[model samples]
Target: MSKEQTLMKLSAILIAALLSITSVAAFSHSGGTDSKGCHRNHKTNDYHCH
Candidate 1:
């Protein structure tokens, strides 16, 4: 493959990866936190602080 084509492919892959990562924030569940600023993860049954 030519250098230009390889660079284009790499750029496209990088953009796709960044997009997928940023999209994860949109899926965060909205919930109430305790007095200590911690919440329970319903899916995992785990408690954590933000």
Candidate 2:
């Protein structure tokens, strides 16, 4: 493949990898909880106590 084509492929792969990583990081949790045993809030991304 030409140099430009190879670079484009690499860029695309890197972008896809970054997006996947970001989504995983954003969704994956460590089972966080508050004093009252409330879990995280999906809308605010903060822990809440019941």
Candidate 3:
């Protein structure tokens, strides 16, 4: 492949990887129960795992 094409592909792949990693990190730190996701449940005073 040409230099420009290779660089572009690499950049795209890198951006995708970074975005996925950031998303996972954000979700993990959301403070949810059972590792589903964090949210307040109206039925009870418990954190939702949805």
Candidate 3 lDDT tens digits, 1-50: 99999999999999999999888766543344554556766579667554
Model 2: per-residue Cα lDDT over 1-50, one tens digit each: 99999999999999999999888866545556766778978898876654
Report the Cα lDDT for residue 16, model 2.
Answer: 99
lDDT of 1 by residue, 1-50 (tens): 99999999999999999999999988856668899889987889999886
Q: How high is the lDDT of residue 29 in model 2?
A: 52
The weakest ten consecutive residues by lDDT in model 2 span 25-34
lDDT (0 to 1) per candidate: 0.90, 0.81, 0.74
User: Which pairs clash inside model 3?
Assistant: none
For model 3 the local lDDT of residue 3 reads 100
Q: Which residue pairs collide in model 1, if any?
A: none
Better of 1 and 2 by TM-score: 1
What TM-scores do the predictions have?
0.57, 0.53, 0.51
Q: Which ten residues in a row have the lowest lDDT in candidate 3?
A: 28-37
Candidate 3 segments whose C-alpha is farther than 4 A from its true place: 28-50
